[model samples]
Target: MTPLSRTCRRLQDSLNSFSNTFIFIFTTSHVRTSLTPTSSTPNSLLNAALITTYPPLKLQNRKPFEAQIDDSLEQPKPIEETAFDALKPTRLPSNVPLYSMGSSSSPSHTIPVVSTFANPFETSNSIDASSSIRKPISLWPGMYHSPVTNALWEARSSTFERLLDPPLDAPPQSELLTKTPLQSRTSVLYNFSTDYILREQYRDPWNEFRIGKLLEDLDALAGTISVKHCTDDDNMTRPVLLVTASVDKMVLKKPIRVDIDLKIVGAVIWVGRSSIEIQIEVTQSTEESSDTSDEIALTANFTFVARDYKTGKSAPVNRISPETDKEKLLWEEADERNKHRKRKRECKREVENGKVDDRLEALLAEGRVFCDMPTLANRDSILSRDTRLENSLICQPQQRNIHGRIFGGWLMNRAFELAFSTAYAFAGAVPYFLEVDHVDFLRPVDVGGFLRLKSSVLYTELENPQKPLINIEVVAHIMRPELRSSEVSNTFYFTFTIRPEAMKDGLKIRNVVPATEEEALHILERMDA
Candidate 1:
C-alpha cells in the first residue's frame, strides 16, 4: 500500500514539474483558479476561495455609494391628477433628478404655476420639471460600486471616479486584447500538481478489469480507463489513479495515470488441445506481386510493460529512477531502428538550386551506421545498403536443373557461405539454434551467375546475461552478372538464432543491437512468425 502511495506521489510530483514547463503551460484562465487536489488517483479538486474589496462609485465629483437618503428625498415627482400611465426612468428610481424648493409654501400655491424645473402638475412625459433637478453627485455602475461615506464625502469620491483617466486600466485591457497570461499560469499550476497520478493509477483499471471479451484486446482498442475498485481475495481493494506534481518532482497522493501504445504483428493466439486446435479459413486478400520491383513482407514481435506500477497509500511503490538506465537504452535502440528502413543511395544526392541542403547532414549523422554502405555498380538501382553480406558473392555456374537452368541449391549455398563468413566469428563459444523460421524462395537461380547476400543482427537474447543468443537476419538476393544491372534472380530470408556462450569468454559484445518493434514482434517467445 505504501509503495502505491509513493508511486502516486511520484507521479504527481512529475506532473507538477512538467506543468510548470513552458511547453506544457496551462493556457486557459479557467484552469488558473486556486485548486487543492486531495488525491492523486482520481484527483479531487476542492472549491477555491475568492478575495475582493467592495468597489466605490462616484457621481458629479461625489461618491454615489455614500450612505444617505438625500437622493431619495431630492428625487422629483409630479402630482398625478389624471389617471394616466407614464414611462418610468430606465435607471434606478433614485437616479431621477430631484429638485429642492424652499420649505415654505411659495406664492406658486396662488394658482400654483409649475416651475419650468419642477412642474408639480406635469405628468411623467410633459417636459417634467423634475427632470431638470440636479444632484450634487453622479454614479456610473460600470465604473464603480457602493461605497461607505457621508453625503459630502461621497460626492467628492464620485468626482474622483469621473476624473480617473482611461489609461489607468490600460494594463488589464492589453492583457485581454492579447492572450490572458493568467490562464497559462493556472494550467501549469494544475498539471504541475497532477502529473504523477497518470503512472500507477492507470494500472488499476486493468488490474480490476476482467478480460471478459475475447479478441477485444487483440483489436488493440483502448480499454475503459475508469472503473470501480474491486476487493481482492486478500481483502485488499484497488484504488483510482490520481497524481500530483511539483516543480520538477511528481508526487502521487493517489494512483497515477499512464497510457501506452502497442502494436502486434503476426500474432498466433487461439492455442488449445487436439479438440482445442482452432482452425478457420483465413482469407488474406492478397495483392498482386510486382515483378519489376522487389517485393517483401516484413514481420516483428513486441511487448509492452511498465517497469513499475506499484500504488497504494501510507507508503507508495519504490521507484527505480536510477535502475532505468539499461531499459532506457534498450527501448531507445529498438524504437530508433523500428522507425527507419534501408535508405536508398539516391536519397543522398541533391541538386536543389545548384546548392546542396546542409540539413541533410543532420539526417546522415543520425543514421551514421547506415550512411557508409558500400557502393556497388548498380548502387541506386536494386541492392540495398544493408544487403552487403549477401551481395558479396557472385553466383557461379552449377549443374543446371533438368531444363538446363542452374539449380536453386547452388545459389542457396552461396547465401549460406556469405552468412557463415561473418556469423562464424561469434560462434567460438556455444551456438544455440533457436529457430529456422519460415524460408521462402522468391525465384529460381541460373548457373554461373553472381548472387549477393546481406545479413544483419536483428536481436539477441541473453538468458544467462553472461551469454547471449543472437538472431541474425540473413537476406540473400540472386542477380545475374551478365545483366546484374537490370535483374535480381532470387531473394530469401534465413533467420538463425545462435548463442555466444561458447565464444571466447573475454570477447565483448559489439555491433549487436536490440530487436525493433517490427522485428521483435516476429520473435516473441515461442510464437512462430
Candidate 2:
C-alpha cells in the first residue's frame, strides 16, 4: 500500500470523481445565477484561489487503509498520548501529520514528507529514528509543548536487562582508610629454584625418564610409579618428591585438560644448606597439601622445627613477622601527627549517597563496610573453653619478645586457643576466662602481620556458658592482592565467667545474668546507651 499509500488511494478516487462533476457544474451555475440577476462564474477569484490551496482529502478508505498500516507495522503500539493526543504537538512523531485529507489536489496525490530534514532510505548519513524533520515537529498550535516535551522526558523504562545498576541499596562496606597510603609499599616473594632437591626419595620422572615425553604434566593422566635414591632401602624409599622443572608453560589460551594426578606424600628434606638457601612452601592446596581427604576432628601439629646446622639444637619455626620497633614509632607518629591530614574530610553533609556506614570519610576510603554481626545462639549455649593442654605441649623455642610483626597480642593469644575448644564443649563442665574488654584500634596492625581470631558466644548470663558476652572479631588479612601494608581493623569485647560444676567439683562461678524480659531489656538498653 505504501507508495505514499497508493498515492493516497488515487487521490481519494480522483477527488470523488471531481466532486461529483463540480457539484453538477455548481448546480447549473447557481441556477443560472439566480435566473440572470448576476450571471458571473468566469474565474471567480481564480476559483477561490484554487480552492483554498488543497489540504483536506481522503473521505472514505476506512478499514483497508492497508488494515491501518497492518496494525501499525505489527504491534508498534505504545505511542499512546490520549489527553486527546496530549493536545498535540509534543514534537509530533508517532507517524503524525496524516490530518484529515479529504478535498482537492489530484494527479494521484502522494505527499510523504518524512524528512530527517531530508532522508532517503537512511544509513550512510544516519538520521531516522522517526525523524520529524530533525526535531521541532510542532510548537505553535496554542503553545504548550510541555516545556518542550520536558526535555525529551526520560521516565526511564530502562532496558538491556536493567543493565546492572540496581545493586546499590548501599550500606555494607567501609573501613579502608588512607590519609594517603594506598600505593607504593612493594614486597613480593615466591621464589623456588636453587637446584631444588628434596630427598626422602621418589625420583623417576627425570623429565619423565629423561626425555621420553609423558611430561606435559602427567599428560593424558595415568599414574604408575616407582622411583629410587635412598640406599638404606626403607623399602624403595619414596616418601615423595615432585620436582617438575621443565619451565615456562603457563601461558595458556584454550583447551586445557588437567585430569589430575598428584598423590605426593611429603619429603621436602635437607636439614642444612645455607648461603641463601630457599624454603618455599606454596602448596596451593591439597588442603595446604595434606588433609585433602579431610578427616579432622582435631589435628593441630604445626611444627616447623629446623635447627641443627652445628647442633645447638633448636626447632620450632613458623616465622612470618618481621619488623617492629613499635612499628617504626607508629609510622613516625603517623608521619608527624597526620602529616597534613586532608585526604577526605570535607563532606559538609547532604550526602545521602549510597549509605554504607554513611560516608565515614567515604566509607573508610571505600572498603565498603557494614557490619551488624553478633548472633550465634543465646540460651541453648556453647561458649568456648578448650583443653588438652598437654598432648599439645613439648615446645623448645621460647625467645619471646615476639615484638614487631606478629603481635596483635600474639595473634590474640593464639586466637584464644581456638576459643577454648568451643567453650569447653559448651560448659558441661568448666569454663573460666574472664574479662577481655572493648578494644577497637579500628586500624593499624602490621609487622609481617598475619591474623585470625574468630570467637563466638552470642548469649548467656549467670546460667553460665561461662558468663558470656563474647563477641570477638579480629580478621586481619593479607593475601598479597597487591599487598596491603599493615592491615588492621578491630572490634573486641570479652567478658567471660563460667564454671560448670567447676570441672565437676572444684568450686567456680559465672556472671552476666539478664535472662529475659528481653534480656532485661537488653541490659537496660546497655545501661541507658
Best by lDDT: 1
Candidate 1 residue-wise lDDT, 437-506, digit = tens: 3233444555555555666544444454455555555665555546646344443333333444434456
Q: Write the per-residue lDDT of candidate 2 for residues 320-353, one digit (tens) a residue.
A: 1214564344345433422222321223121223
TM-score of 2: 0.16
Off by over 4 Å in 2: 1-184, 187-406, 427-438, 441-529
Residue 96 lDDT, candidate 1, scale 0-100: 28
List candidate 1 stretches off by more than 4 Å. Answer: 1-397, 426-434, 463-467, 480-508, 514-528
- All models: lDDT? 0.29, 0.26
Assess candidate 1 and give its TM-score to the true structure: 0.24
Task: Please tell me which predicted candidate would have the highest TM-score against the true structure.
Answer: 1
The TM-scores of all predictions, comma-separated, are 0.24, 0.16
Residue-level lDDT for 470 in candidate 1: 50
Per model, how many backbone clashes are there? 102, 25
